[model samples]
Target: MAETYPVLQEAEPFYFEGNDIGILVIHGFTGSTQSMRDLGEAYAKEGYTVCGPRLKGHGTHYYEMEQTTYADWIASVEEGYQWLKERCQTIFVTGLSMGGTLTLYMAENHPDIQAIIPINAAIDIPDMAALQNERETRFLDAIGSDIKKPYVRELAYDKTPVKSVKEIVMLMEKVRNGLHKIQCPALIFVSTEDHVVPPGNSQMIFDNISSRQKRLVQLDNSYHVATLDNDKELIIEETLRFIKRS
Candidate 1:
């Protein structure tokens, strides 16, 4: 039997209608829409239609996350994309951490995406071998809310399910292999001192993606959750600029 968990506060999905340009905002692994609401609202303020989908098995509980697969998470994003497609002429996708990996996945599978902004995306997990070997551990310490800003925290799971971690690794492998298939303009961001995903992941993504129009930016004052960190404004501003030019 499957266990059910209640959704956490401030973790509900959000949608804002606006102009023809649609922006799909995705949160990271073990995270909820709360981590991306600020960015979504900013885009909405700029007259861009925004949709922030709550990924399956997330925003509820780590136990629920363990029951989900990467395919389920991708399906959540696909539903959001299709919703936007129905009403908008142009679409842009951006995400944080695992969300960023999904963004790349979308770009690879759907060429209709206008551009992408991946913030601190994970590609190569340096300790993946170790994680894979640990068969007994069901969960690990929380990897969320890596923000440098004081008093600010992301709405993410306090524990990470090992099963979900494996799913993300599988997704990363798939996305990495399909990098060449992503030809849309891209803007990648990496925090200089990210505690979760290493900065090198962004570099590898930049070098592998076939996008001719791509830029890599470094956030000096933030960490992995840059969207909710001190440099949140920078991410919002730069993303808007990237969308306009792309």
Candidate 2:
């Protein structure tokens, strides 16, 4: 028999049905749905239906991540979106890091997405061209768990697969190029002290997107994983306000 492993409590997916306005939350590249749990729950409490899907190869072993690509992750998001679409009259998408990138991609391709919230969305990373050229190694140091809050760790693979990193780089380029297609209102958050993603990523999105109704908020106290850091409450409040006004 093949070996099986139980999913960690924090890594499990979460769904809460509440109201007609549904929210689809997406986590980072190697990170699990736990990263988005608090935000999803907050939105759910506000009488909005919410779903956070475990991305392909995440919430599992690192080797499994090597077998997946960005397309697989996007497919997972699409599945969650379809699930929410069936039950809700309107839908919004939110994400952190690569999750943010996926959020923008969905907004571009899916015209019906009511609004988008992308925090610390990855666009261009440092030396991404060289990283894509790497072939000798299959993995690199993990960049997913970059939270600055002490004792609070983001659940992710110890090592990031180079293949997956390349996939993310490709996804960033694709999303960046297609920013013009994203017409929905967007509320972007950029953490100034982010250790993993450069602040320029958020700036790139803000500058390139054709959305006339867009705003950028800078987070001074948090790191890349701002959803779980010091400014988490601020994010929650701002997102709620944005949803109401949108």
Candidate 3:
């Protein structure tokens, strides 16, 4: 018999009502709402309506993710955004890792989005063709919890399904091709020592986006999952500051 895995309560979706400025927080691929929970709570405490949706097939198990695709993941964010649109007059979007990619995609498609904040967004990746070549392989060691801080936790699958990685690569390609269409104000965060995604990926986004008001902030003490790493406060503070100034 196959072992069973269920989503943890803390990894489930969360929503908090606050002010008119709603923030749609998105977590990375293979990661649950747990990764974005604290960020959402912080924004809510500051009087911003916040929602964190668990991405499709995530926070459950690798087998579930193997059956999913990037479109399914984007639908999760769209659902959250639609929820916000009904209540809030203004909507601000923020996402970490693959969440960032979806945020950029959203900004391109949704001109009504006031601003976008992409933290370590995976717009472009290294050697994506090679990854697609190995899609038939079962799994690889998980890179979802690549945090620099000790004892910090990010709820993610233990193994990465290679087929799912192929879908991620496909998403990156689509996001990169549409980067020039992202005209909304964007604030991008990149960690100097990221292990899962190279710094060049962030650079490519900063270069390609057509946003007139954009800034790239670099983190010194964090890794890939900066939201769960040493620089988390920096992310929260900087994001709030950007929202105020935007």
Candidate 4:
């Protein structure tokens, strides 16, 4: 069995509220809180409080995750938001992939976020019409039986719930229709050739968000996991700039 990660019964505060800056790192679907672990440490070292919460139904069996909905995941983020609110007066949200989508969702409602950084976020998931027609494809069993790839893209041992995936695609549609309402300082990063998330998602967000301070940086190396990809530096640097500016 794989060893569990920084096992914690309660959420860990990344820093003190008295410090004036805090960060909440949200992980992607089917991914554990550890996806933002390295970034959390980087924030903590820089004297900012950071908390990366495990989304609902993650860090365990994949098949068991099917029961969770997007709302459940949002609740987890809300809990982190409340927790960080206690100590840090200002909190910035950042996420990878599905995590990024959640961050945007949170920032949409919570304007207290100083800045929102989306790493490899898909504002719109392409091939949705195609995916809907092919939902019955054997993604789970194929995922389960296949050996872990050498590229360190090992999934969280969780299965993708078709319903959950459907919900994500639906959520993307909702955001696309209401992008004008999001007015926070947004920083979006896109992988030119990301296989999982189409590049247009980032473009749409960059083009639609009403914030003048927003920026979109293109990444060539990191596929979907910009947190751990070769162009991860650009992520850290750009994020740091947003944190400092906000």
Which residue ranges in model 1 land beyond 4 Å of their true spot? none
- For model 1, residues 1-246, the per-residue Cα lDDT tens digits are 889999898999999999999999999998999989999999999999999999999999899999999999999999999999998999999999999999999999999999999999988887753586678999999988888899998999999988888888889999999999999999999999988898999999999999999999999999889999999999999999989998
Provide the TM-score for each candidate, comma-separated: 0.98, 0.96, 0.96, 0.84
If the candidates were sorted by their lDDT against the true structure, best first, what order would they fall in? 1, 2, 3, 4
Candidate 2: tens digits of C-alpha lDDT, residues 1-246: 323446667998889988899999999988999899999999999999999999988888777888888899999999999999989999999999999999999999999999999999998887664698897998788877678789888888888888888999999989989998988999999999888888998988998888999999999989999999988999999999999999
lDDT string for model 4 (1-246, tens) is 333344333223243333657788887766666556777877777788777877766766555466667788889888988888888878899988778888788877887677899887756776543565555653443122111223555345435666666667776776567777778889888887776677888888888878878988998766676676677667887788778886
lDDT tens digits by residue: candidate 3, 1-246: 444468877788999988899999999988888888889999999999998988888888899888889999989999999999988999999999999999998998899999999999996677544787773579988887899899987888899888888999999998889999988899999999888878878888999999999999999999999999999999999999999988
Which clashing pairs does model 1 show?
none
Decide which is better by TM-score, 2 or 4: 2
Clashes of each: 0, 0, 0, 4
Instruction: List runs of model 4 lying over 4 Å from the truth.
Output: 1-18, 128-151
lDDT of 4: 0.71
Least accurate stretch of 10 residues (summed lDDT) in model 2?
1-10
**Which one is best on TM-score?**
1
lDDT of 2 at 192: 95
Candidate 4 clash pair list: 15-49, 17-87, 62-158, 62-159
Candidate with top lDDT is 1
True-vs-predicted CA distance for residue 122, candidate 1, Å: 0.8
